[model samples]
Target: MAKLLEIRWHGRAGQGAKTAALVLAEAAISAGRYAQAFPEYGPERMGAPMQAFNRISDEPITVHSHVTNPSIVVILDPTLIAATNVKAGVPADGIYLVNTTMGPCEMRKRLGLTDSPAKVYTLDATQISMDTIGRAMPNTPMMGALVGATGLLELDQLIADTREKLGRKLRPEIVEKNIEAIRRAFQEVAS
Candidate 1:
């Protein structure tokens, strides 16, 4: 939390990338930190590719624009690796948290990032979400991975905030299941 932590989220429409970014921003604000979250859309349809950005820091964020260079990048759809330059603008020390069934090592090789300085982490978030929430949504689980990989916020705080934010619009059971997904994803993400 010493410097601004910028995060870029890559996901398709209906995958909850925007929702996850908003939730993470809200969680950061709830923890008394300054944050910003917003989404960039393309075709504006389900299954269309999109991007979301988040900036969390101890100080106020003065910039209001897309995050071209992110400290962390969360890829909700592994397919984007082949479809887009998911690693664009990322520095050597950046971290990539990808939602994929493949292990990190395999993912690195698949993405041809074995020589890259950026650290790569992978988690079967879709499986975790399907198992816990009965859906294939990877956004919530990816948030857990984001926290786990970055440590920008505490795990408990994230769960509490997620429950509170989603509790209003969703069923109690769904909320609980999402929390479980988050917890499992946090623990299960592999480097």
Candidate 2:
């Protein structure tokens, strides 16, 4: 990437938004890109709204504040659409990858992006995770959807990095299933 890329992720508290940000940063670093990831939350409990941010560039990252204007915005919970301003800080040319049963056209309308230049992509990431990982975590699958939308990272490498990170805390079978979720989302996302 010639310029810095900022990505903001929105999800419920227990949905792995923070984990996804960390994995995305680690995966980018493994690819020789400079990156940073962090989460923003208060005393929110499970299923509460939360956000995570990522900054990625070929060169070193300097800005340490929250991502106010993101080039990419990812929403891991479809229900957040009704309660959150998911488009906040997104630029006119920004991209949105949403976890939903809706297609891009429907998502565009839902997000009020019909006349905006921003691009929209959609996927039933929850279903993908449930089917592959036997859970509802959408983070890893959303990471793959992000890759599918932008070609930002090598899919196999991201999966490898995710596996390595998840392997530290998860069982081998669960890790493999998450990897499957990622691959499935990458292929199934509607652009």
Clash count, one per candidate: 0, 0
Question: Whole-model lDDT, candidate 2?
Answer: 0.93
Q: Best-fitting candidate, measured by lDDT? A: 2
After superposition, the stretches of candidate 1 with alpha carbons farther than 4 Å from their true spots are none
* Lowest lDDT block of 10, candidate 1: 41-50
For residues 1-191, what per-residue lDDT tens digits would candidate 1 score against the true structure? 65888899999999999999999999999999999999996669998889999999999899997899997889999999888888889888788899998999999888778888878999999999999999899999999988897788999999999999899899999999999999999999899
Measured by TM-score, the strongest candidate is 2
What are the RMSDs of all candidates, in order?
1.0, 0.8
Query: Model 2, residue 117: what's the lDDT?
Result: 92
Question: Residue 57 of candidate 1: its Cα lDDT?
Answer: 91
Error of 2 at 66 (Å): 1.1
